[model samples]
Target: MKDKIILKVETAGTRVDAYLASCLKEYSRGYFQRLIDMGHVLVNSQKTASSCRLKEGDEIEIIIVNKENKIKPENIPLEIVYEDKDIIVVNKRPGLVVHPACGHPEGTLVNALAGHFKGKFVPYLVHRLDKDTSGVMVVAKNEKVKASLVKQFQNRTISKEYIAAVGGNVSENEGRIEAPLGRSHQDRRKIVVGPLAKKMAITEFKVLSRHSGYTVVAAHPITGRTHQIRSHFAFIGHPVLGDETYGGPLKIGEKSFERQFLHAHKLSFTHPSKAKKVEFSAKLPKDMAWLSKKH
Candidate 1:
């Protein structure tokens, strides 16, 4: 997919990178410089440098390519939830990585999808879930669908719901956590709620049931951030059960669980091909279901 942005210069003698950075605050100046260097940014239909000064009435066009490096296909099994010509929804299991990264090179969901649709369209992941978090995920089969789904996510038009077993009994029936999230200053790997947060993260939760020492809550994250739900719950002193990273209880009613008791229970978005809203859901995995019943 190609993204084109046209900007007409209103003031003269401003550097190209400076003007673009002022116009597009979501992107960094370094990103605009790279785009200018790559000939993606053009002035008056001609390629220009980042340091080039802009003049009045000058037309600037920026073209960005949305593409990912080709990945290898692996023969891993997939729990498909829904599929069509343009998109495929999967019930991603815990311990499954969404894509290939530095440490996780194989055995990923993308690899499995690639193998499943060999000789057909390569799957493009629209969003991601943590490796330890099992959930419903959607993949785009084509570039147009990928662009549409990505835009919907950015616009916050998609609704994501999760079911989690939290430690201790929550007193409130429903509540909202509106906090800014950023990397922890002390622990680089963990996120913290602080004034230095660059982005705002909000989570709305309702208690589903209260057990002997745990509470099951349905969470809806308004803004998707890294470990947003886990961190927010931890901040409220109700870490998810079995999530060691956030001080979640290791066992529920004397039964030990291996991973976090969080599941992406539901996902709603506009269908790119059908042009209608559709919602997909994944039932709780065996371990979580067992804990929920036993408690």
Candidate 2:
């Protein structure tokens, strides 16, 4: 069996494989290159190479070979913040994967939502957070709700606030990072800011407090790029503590962190069912709270 996807190029001058990876973040650029090699990708109704540069308004069609495996419901505990007919909001704990992928097939937030809903409606993911970043996340109950929330995110109308403790004392009280982000050429899993960057990423941050050599800051990402906050801070030489991938130290003096010291403190978006604005907030976990107080 196979599934087909069609996409229209919004921006020009990007490689086909890179464009595909940007549109579907679940898959990697290498995976798309393999698909193109296998003749499963077509541009403008003709089979195209992975290095093909896309023009604005170019049509891309992909045929993905389906696997037999399906996501199974698992009895995992979830901290439900808000629930309604249209959506469900959860304060996702750190270390929990948002969905199943190649390496992680179970024990994810999606599987937990599946089990929680059980015979009820299936959960539809609208957005995602990193595995090590604990945060407030929203899930749609149906496609209609998912479309509405996704559109809000696309239009940059949704508001997201995050708190993070980064290495080094930030001199600026408030500042904005306007950098372009894309997958690293050396490491596919990592994101970096440079000339090869494909998308514009913006993050505005304000210093909450200064402690020893570290600083606690509130970050608001204007663009919903992958690892936007983490990469932006790291680009400014202030990586989030415990985020070793971005050059952050694991141990700050006597204190040690198991995961990135970042949290999605608040999120605001218009309700899909009701035409009113709504907001959700999640408290900082024990480790972060303790570290903040100790320093």
For each candidate, the alpha-carbon lDDT, in order, equals: 0.84, 0.85
Total clashing pairs for each candidate: 0, 0
Worst 10 residues of 1 by lDDT: 63-72
State how far residue 28 of model 2 sits from its true place (Å): 22
Question: TM-score per candidate, in order?
Answer: 0.76, 0.78
User: Which parts of model 1 have CA positions greater than 4 angstroms off?
Assistant: 1-70, 291-295
Cα lDDT over the full model 1: 0.84
lDDT of 1 by residue, 1-295 (tens): 6554455565679999998887665567998898898899999779999889997647676765563323567889888999989999999999898765335546788779888988487676678888889989999988799899999999999999999989998999999999989877687667778889988899999998888888889999999988899999999999998888888989766688688889999999999989999999997877777645643
